[model samples]
Structure formats: structure tokens, C-alpha cells
Target: MDSAPIVVHPPTGSGGRRVTVRGEILGLAHSDADVVEFLRRAGLPDAEGLLDDSAWVKWRGGRAHHYEAA
Candidate 1:
């Protein structure tokens, strides 16, 4: 399988997930909009659309849209 370019790491104690693109750490995201904004700042176009595209984003240690740690 092809690896995704963006990775949304598991939520931290503060309920924020770490967003990374191409191995570069973007920032902590508390919501989908935050993720999109991070991507936008990283010079990515159509970042909102990328959130749902599995080929573009890989959500690890939790489900997509889930920010609270279990």
C-alpha cells in the first residue's frame, strides 16, 4: 500500500494530535480545521479535501476526527 504524505498522530493528554507532513512536524491540531490550517501554512492546496483522503492523510493510534485519548 502507498504511504500517506500527512500523518495525524494519536491524541495527547491535552486532546491535541500532532500533525506532520512528509516527516516534517507541522503542529498540534485540536480539530479538523486546525489540521487543514496547518496544511495550508505548509503550502498545501485543498487541505480540507485532504482530510478525507486516505492517500493523503494517515490517522494513527486513533480514528479520524477523534481527538480525545482513550
Candidate 2:
């Protein structure tokens, strides 16, 4: 598995994705803003910008910015 600092897990049945930072579960995010907020709270700089940065975040089971399950 990729060892990125942030990982946005696959969306759940309710379309919420689990956001984790350094293996720490931040929360379940339903939107990009929620993920950004989680990162902000975790003290990560430029949280929103990191969304598209593969080196910073690893998006699993979905494309970037996609909250709904495939």
C-alpha cells in the first residue's frame, strides 16, 4: 500500500468516506470540504490543495473528489 500521510478510504453505503491521517482516523467525510476541515484540524497546511496531491493524500476505491461509491 502507498504510505501517504493522508488516506481517503472507499465510500461507505451512505456515501461517506473515512479520512485518516498518519493512520489516525480523523472522521467520516461526506464532501471535499469535510476532508479539508479534517486536515486543517490535524494541523496540515494547505489542506484543500493537498486533495489533488498524490504524495500527500491517497484516494482509495474512488477518484479524487468523488464521494459516491462506484
Candidate 3:
């Protein structure tokens, strides 16, 4: 099976980097809105609804960044 690309957006003042995971990480952003922006930029379908148990991201950077439900 194929997986999603991993995109990492640098942190602004949130302390943690924003990440969008389709299969891996499609892109990064500061917030879900930004993440959607990334999706718009990529010209890809919004997979925000696909975020669930299938996506397991363990950040070694301590606490997780702010993310929104798809």
C-alpha cells in the first residue's frame, strides 16, 4: 500500500511544529486552518476526515503540537 508524504512546518510561537498526516505527513502548519491551507496548496483532496487510529505520531519533542480533528 502507498503512504502519505510527511511535511514539516516549522514552529512559530506555539513551541511545536505543525504537521498534517494523510498516511505519513502531507504537510505542516501552525493550526488546522493552516493545515487546510497546506492541502489547498498541494492541490490535494482534504483528508482531514482520515485522521484517526490509523495515524499514530509520537513526537520526541515532548508534548504534542496543537492539532484539529478532521
State the lDDT of candidate 1 residue by residue for 1-70, as single tens digits.
3299999999998788999988889999999999999999999868998898999999988789998865
TM-score of each: 0.90, 0.90, 0.40
Clash count per candidate: 0, 0, 3
lDDT values for all models:
0.90, 0.89, 0.46
Order the numbered candidates by lDDT, best leading. 1, 2, 3
Candidate 3 local distance difference test against the native: 0.46
- Candidate 1 lDDT score at position 25: 96
Clashing pairs in 1: none
Candidate 1, residue 58: Cα displacement in angstroms equals 0.3
State which candidate, 2 or 3, has the greater lDDT: 2
Q: Best-fitting candidate, measured by lDDT?
A: 1
**Could you give me the TM-score of model 2 versus the true structure?**
0.90
Predicted candidate 2 versus true structure: per-residue lDDT over 1-70, tens digit per residue:
5679899999988788999988889999989999999999999768999998899999999777888854
Tens digits of lDDT, candidate 3, 1-70: 2243434344545344556544445555555566556665656465454333234333323233454222
